[model samples]
Target: MTDVVATTPGLFPLPDWAKEDLSDLKGHQKGDLVSGGEGGEIARAYDRVRNEVVDDQTDAGLDRFVEGQARWDDMLAHPLTVHENVETGGIVRYYDNNNFYRDPRVTGELTFSGDVAAELEAASGLLGSDADDRLQAVLPGPYTLADLASDEYYGDEAEFLAAVSEFLAGEVEAFPAHATLFLLEPSFVTNAPDDDLDERASEAIDAVAGATDADVVVHTYWEAFAEKPYAHLMDADVDALGFDFVAADREANLECINEYGTKGDVALGLVDGQNTLVEEPGTIAERVNWVREQVPGQEFDTTYVSYNTEPFYLPTSKHVEKLSAIAEAARLAATEGVEA
Candidate 1:
């Protein structure tokens, strides 16, 4: 029931500023060479949003985070959370001293809440003219999130996937009513045991599809899709499939596309979302054309351009701005190609 349009999928470059912010937060959390501590971007990455609201007395960092959650809708009111980082990986939530009212991570059911849904809707709205064209609502799929969590949650792999499916189903049903499709990322399907991977992946997809009113998309990257392991994804009741062509075997993706011919949409990720470079729009357009040839008669218009991955290069906010550029380029390419 969500608005449907033919638009390419992609993201822009990571801004330079995020690096410093990431560094600062990291230094604060673990200490530097001058002092003994665990060093990584985790803490600095944590700080960008953490330092914004809370006070000096509290775990200022955690407090700032909880405060953000309280006003998430207001913060997201802007085209962008100038104060928010778009990155998905990191601490999922921030809680009070007693662990009440926690801010959850993007990878779980927590993302399906009203506050997050409003953020997604606001982000889509920010695209302005580009909103009508195809854009995606990226969510972490059950399999990926379940796998990413500590093993303590589930009894075994089987039990783990089942619980994941149920958890995601609830989340799927909670997404904003207007969003066209929820692109669930299942990055860990590649690492799962061969025998169980596909079944687990399909169940996860089905769970989301059944749970939500929106379209469910199974997106995978950084792995080969044609291999037996990936074939399992074909079983999911997806409205479309998103493949990472930047790092994946193009032949395999094409093969899958052919095999799955028009059962749903094919979101071809030609732009590299993970890199900081402002890629040549021309090169991406040409690649989309080449992919069109492989599909023959599908027309270049049917294919949408997108990044193979998220811009993990910098902070999430900068990355989103970068992603915005990619979206513009792809839209132009698709419009022109369709007209031609």
Candidate 2:
């Protein structure tokens, strides 16, 4: 029997209180009225939000917990934009969504100085004894980061991708032993690179996966990858590959799995992250079983019932409801003997 668990593919929205605190701090900064003690106010506000998110996830009985990525101003590009060598450029729409993120322009050699690792460390402190077993570290995959960035220094795309892979490996190396590492790669489905570079992309993903002891999952959302691209993605030596059954072309993705098969573990995105409607737990469990039935003989050791993408697009109240539904669905799936 497979072990089914509840988890989220990271980024969560800030709470109303946090928003108010941050607004006040921003006002003070613009007026030059910020005091020395207030320099750490933003960090404090983030900590408060992180604590609340962790508490909510715990209460909902989610098997895996994330830092919630509340500190990220620009979801995928935050780590790169914060680096000294990179400059923030004009806003670009985030993958056909209403959300926008400033482009990270790479002007110099890329380097990692514990950007996301710091956030993971802070989140780890909240879990106490369960930290090693439940805490999940989320980061942008090399291919996604490279694709999103504006490369001025490394004129070549291949070279830029390699540098990003190496830089992200450093961040992974800095993390303490944890349960899972979700390397979000929406670009794989939204804006796939050339077919010739597929092998290079897999190699880059493997390089980062090899850096840590945790189980690495390359999670893609928004849509399903085309056949050739999906085949290339399977070449990576990561533990599991996540698929968005909600927003993706379900029949196409299921066909890919039936033909190509999958690895030992898989993540099923059953909950609608962006929508306000909450799904019934039994219905979600049925979908999980339905997917298992579609791909005959493809067994897995673990199955994650998660949101198709981050729930940042939803209101906090609805997001909490979805979390409870995910946990309940996982429990139901496990009880009903749904094979992974």
lDDT against the true structure, each candidate: 0.46, 0.86
TM-score of each: 0.61, 0.95
Q: Which candidate is the best by lDDT?
A: 2
Strongest candidate by TM-score? 2
Clashing pairs in 2: none
lDDT string for model 2 (74-142, tens) is: 788877888879988999988887898889999998887686787788889999987999999899899
Clashes of each: 17, 0
